[model samples]
Every structure is written in structure tokens, then in C-alpha cells.
Target: MLLADFIRDGAARLEKLYPSPEARGLVLMLCRELLGVTNYTHVVEPRTAVPEERLPELEAALARLCAGEPIQYVLGVAEFCDRRFVVGPGVLVPRPETELLVAEAVRTLQEMELDRAPRVLDLCTGSGCIAWSIALDIRDAEVIGVDVSETALDYARKQFPQGPSFIQADVLDTEQAFPYGPFDLVVSNPPYVLERERTQMRPNVLDWEPDLALFVPDDDPLRFYRAVARWAQRFLRPGGVGLVEINEALGPETAEVFRAAGFKNVRNLPDFYQKDRFVRFQTPDNQAINN
Candidate 1:
């Protein structure tokens, strides 16, 4: 089959779910990844043909896309912080916005005193994207990622041969004691989407992503933020910093959770979209602020 024809057909089938340009982009990406063809290959080489043996595989991938499976999950990888992280049915696909949380955490760690190796903790560390990103970017940084789901932990643990230590524990289990602590930084991108917000999400996410990693009760949408505060209080060192991605609608409420936990310098930070997407705070200490 001609490569152009395949892409045209795939994009048309995918248009039912995605916009025209986006559908075309998905088809292009699929071709690039699976066929090693550049996006402009079909346009520049109109006679390019997809090998007969690979046609079936391409068709299978297009079918999955047309059925509402996310491209990342279908490809079994999601790019975050310029690195690829494995993702699948049981694990949540990392989002582009979550990269902001990683950027903030990386900047905070770099600005702090590096007299000794910095310690970091990541709560509800689905796929360990943030945790691994920080560890890889910061030399000798001790990072630990905690998640309740064994499936998520498995994916997180395998992301790097020697990155953050991935542990299995519930973020909401206040009574459970974590063996490692006294971190210089605490970070999380926990479950902040309210159940009622499902109507606002796309079917690909609703049908494919892990619900355990994406949602909270509408009546208590701030539950994960409250849990993050508890983890920060217990694990973060004096004057240490904490950052977490949040639902834009509850920015102030989420920040209040950290402030009420006795953190100072609590503030909501905007993402690329300028939405109130993250909260950063400092654990109380008499030490002078490190500029």
C-alpha cells in the first residue's frame, strides 16, 4: 500500500475522535514511529509504499486509535521532561502539564544548598515521571517515589536502572509509616480531578487511563492535597520545599491545605496555560531563606 494512502485513510478514521489536524498529526507520528518515515515523507515522495508485511501492524494500530485508545498507551510510551516513560493499561499516562511540576521541583532543588546530596520524596508517584526526572537531572540526588498500586510501582521502578527508589504505600494511609524520610524536597501529582469533572474529560482518558491515579470523590476533591500536606510535614526537612500539581478550580483550597499544615511561603503557581496548576510551600524553620 502507498504510504500516502495509508495516512489519508488512518487520519480520516481517526477524525471521528480527533480534530483534522490532530488526527493527521497522530497518523504522521504513527508512521514515523512504526515505519521510520519522516512526517514529510509522503508529501516529498508520493510513490513511497508501506511494506506489505508491515501493513497489518499499521492497520492494527490505527484500529486501536480509532477505538479511543490514547496514542501514548497504544505506543506503550509517553514523553515527559524530554525522556520517554513506559505507560500501559494499569498505569496513568503522564501529561505535558505535569512537566511544570517537575520544572519547579528541579529549579527549587538546584537553588537550594548543594553542600550535601539533596533528598526528595514523590507521593502517588504514578509512572515515577517526576521522581525519575529530578533524579536524572540532579547529580547524587536521593529520590524516593511512593505509590499504592503495584502496577504503577512496577512501571516506576523500571523507568531507570538506577534512579529513584520506588516504594509501595498508600498516600492516604496516614497511620502507615514510611521507612525513608527527612527529604529536602517533597513533590506529587496526586489524584486531584473530581469525579464530577468527568464530563469535561475526553473519552480516551476516561476509557484508557487508570481511574485510581486520576480521580477523587466530588465531595472531597482535595483529599490528595491534604494527604500531600501530611507527607510534607512528616518527610520534608526544616525549611524544605514542597510542590504538587493541582486542579485549577481548587487552587486556593489546595494551597490552604499546605498552609494549614504549618507550611510558610505557600503560593499557587501557573502552568503554561496560566491556570492555577501547582502549589509550592516551605516547611517552617528558623533558618534564613536561601536566595
Candidate 2:
């Protein structure tokens, strides 16, 4: 079958789900990844043809897309921090904006003059993207990721064969004793979306992504932030930093949670869209003299 024909038909079928340009882009990406063709292959070689034997597999992929399955999950990988992360039915697909959290954490670690390897902890790590990204970016850094779901942990643990240690623990269970401690940096992108905000999300996400990694109760939208603050209080070393992705609507409140927990330098950070997407806080320097 001709590549152009496949592209045309696939885009037409996906038009109802995505905008015209986006549909075409998805189709082009699918073709490039599955058939090893360039994005502009059809443009450059209008006569390019898909291998007859490969047509069935391509059609199967198109059917999945038409059914609103996310392309990343359909392809079994998602790109984060210029790295590919394994993702499937049980784990959350890593988002581009969460890369900002990794960037900020990396910058914080770089600025600190530590004599030994820096210890970092990631809370509610669905796919260990932040944990593994930090581990790979920082030399000799110790990184650990915590998640409650065994399924999510399975995916996170395999992301890097010898990368961050992925552990199973409930972040919201304050009563449970967390064994890891005294981290130089603590980061998380927990469930910040409120139940009431479900309408704002697309069906692709609502249907495919893990709810445990995506949402919070409507009455307490900042629950995970509160838990993150508590975790930082116990695990973060003096003058250490904490960063977490947050719901845009609860930015100020989320920052306040850290401040109220006695963290210093608590502030809200913006994502690429200039929205209140993250909160950064620092633990008090315990060595400072209290004159």
C-alpha cells in the first residue's frame, strides 16, 4: 500500500478525535516509527510504498489510535527528559510539563556543593521519570522513587536496569514509617487533579491513564501536596530542596502547605505555559545560629 494513501486515510479517520494538523502529525509519527520512514517521506517520495507484509501491523496501530488509545501507550513508550520511558495500561504516561520538575531538581542539585553523593527521593513516582532522569543527569547521585501501586513500580523499576531504586510505599499513609531519609532533594508529581476537574481532561487520558496517579478528592485537592510537604519535613536534609508538579488552580494553596509545614523559601514555579505548575521549597538550615 502507498504511504500517502495510508496517511490520508488514517488522518481522515482520526480527524474527529484530534484537530486536522494534530491528526496528520500523529499519522506521520506512526508511519515514521513503525515503518522507519522519515516524517517527510511522503512529501519527498510521493511514490513511497509500505511493505505489503507490514500493512497489517500498521492497520492495527491505526485502529488503536482510532479507538482513542494514547499514541505513547500504543507504542509502549513515552519520551521524557530526552529519554524513552516504558509505559502501558497500568502506569501513567509521562508528561512534557513534568520535565520542568526534573529540570528544576537538576539545577538545584547542581547548585549545591555537596562533598558526597547527593541523595534524592521521589514520591508517588508513577513511571520513575523524575527519579531516573535525575539519576542519569547527575553523576554519582543516589535516587529512590516511591509508589503505592505494584504495577506502576514494575514499570518504573525496569525503566533503567541499574538506575534509581523504585520502592512501593503509600505517600498518603502518614502513619507508615518511611525508611528512606535525609535526602538532599525530594521531588514528586503526585495526583493533583481534582475529581471535579475530570471534565476538562480528554477521554484518551480519562480512559487509559491510571486514576491513582492522576486524581485527588474534590474536597481536598491539595491532599497530595500536603503529604509531599510531610515527606519533605521528615526526609529532606537541612537546607535541602523539594519540588513537585501541582494543579494550576491550587498553586498558591500548595505553596502555602509547605510554608505552613515550616519549610523556608517556599514558592510557586511556572511551566512552559506560564501556569502555576510547580512548588519549590527549602528546608531550614539547622546549623544557622538563632541569635
Candidate 3:
């Protein structure tokens, strides 16, 4: 069948599940993924014929789409910080908003002027995107990724076997011993979406994306932040900064949580859409544990 015919049929079906623009996008991405076509406009316009072998995969993806599975889950990968990371229904798909979290991490790491390799950590690492991106960009930096999901960490280990160490552990478990970092930076895009908001999400997301990686109790939106800030106080060295992605609307509350936990230099920053999407806080004086 011709690519245009495929798109026409696929778009029509996808529209039943997604908005027009997103449906069109899925069709275009599928064309590129299956056909190795760089220019999707050509596929949409000229209507080139699809190869015989690519049919089965496209058919399966279309079926999954009709079932309200997100395209990222169907693709089994998501792009973040201009790099590909393994993703599935089991893990939260990295979003563009998280890129702001990473960019801030990179900027802060650069400013530290470390002549030697700096240590970094990505807590609640889902796909290891943030950890791997830091290692890939900073070159000399050593990164470690920690997550409670063994399945998620397994996927991350496959993606970065030697580049960064992947650990399976819950962030809130005090019995779990994290390496004494004295890390130059620690970062995360941890679950912050409120539990109540789940029903309002699009079917493609709410139906497929894992809740453990997305939603938190609305009664305590800063649960993860409070845990991570305490961890930073213990593991991060003096002047080391922690970066995190958070709900845009909760900027003040997040800042307060970090500050109350003894983190200093607390600042909330905006994403590309001008939403309060990222926060940074530095460890002060590397305080003694009792203090």
C-alpha cells in the first residue's frame, strides 16, 4: 500500500482516539519509523508506497492506538534532551517540560568549574534519560541513577551499562544506603502529578502510562521533594545543587519545602512555556547530620 494511503487510513482511525493534530503527528512518526523516511512532508504529500515487510508493524501499532495506548508506549522509546530513552507502559514517558529540569542541571554543573570528573545523581530515574544525558554532555562527569522499579532500572541498565550505575531502591527508604555523593549535582523529574488529576488526563495517557511514575497524593504534593531534599543534605557536599521538575502551579510550595529542609539558594525557574517548571537548591555548608 502507498504511504499516503496508509496515512489517510491511519489518520482517520487515530482521530477517533486523539485530536486531529496529534493523530497526524502519530501517522507522520510511524511513517518515519517504519519507512526510514526523514522527510514526513514528502510522505504526507507524494504518497510513496510502503515496503511489503513494514505492513505488520504498522498494523499492530494502529491496533494499539485504537485501544488508547499512547504513541510513545507503542514506539517503546521517547526522546528527551535530544536523546532517545527506552519507555513503555511500565514507565512514565519523558516530556518536554522535563527538559527544562535537565537544562538547568547542565548549566549548574558547568558553572562548578570542576577540573576533574564531577559526580552526579538522577534520583527516581525512570529511563535514565537525565543521568545518561548528563554523562553524555559533561563527558567527564560520573552519573548514578536510582529508582524503586527493578523493571525500570533494568531498561535503564541496558541503555547505559557502563556510562552510569543504575540502582534499584525507593527514595523514601532510609535503610537504603545511597553512595556518599558529595555530588556536584543531583536531579530528578519525579512523580508530582496529583492523584485527583488522573481522571482528567487523555485516555492515551491515563490508560497506558504507569501511575507510580506520575501521580502522588494530593494531600502531600511535596512528598518526593521532602525526601530528596533530606537525601541531598546527607549525600550532597557543600555548595552542591539539586535540580527538580515540578508542577508549574506549585512553585511557591516546592520552594518552601526545599527551604524548610535546610536547602539554600532555592530558586524556581520557568520552562519554555513560561510555567514555573523547574527548581534548584544548593546544600549549605555541608551541615553535620545532627544539625
Which digits, one per residue and each the tens of the lDDT, describe model 1 over residues 1-291? 999999999999999999999999999999999999999999999999999999999899999999999999888899899999999899999989998888889899989967999999999998999999999999799999999999999999888789899888888986576778788998999998889999999999999888999999989899888888887777778889999999999999999998788889999999897999999999878552321
lDDT of 1 at 119: 97
| Tens-digit per-residue lDDT, 8-36, candidate 3 | 88989988878898887888887787678
What TM-score number comes out for model 3?
A: 0.93
As for candidate 3, its clashing pairs are none
What TM-score does prediction 2 earn?
A: 0.97
Candidates' lDDT values, in order?
A: 0.90, 0.90, 0.82
Better of 1 and 3 by lDDT: 1
Q: In candidate 3, how many Å is residue 131 off?
A: 0.4
37-154: candidate 2 lDDT, tens digit per residue: 9989998999999999999999999999999999998889999999999999989999999998999999999999788999999999898988999999997999999999999999
lDDT of 1 at 123: 90
Off by over 4 Å in 2: 287-291
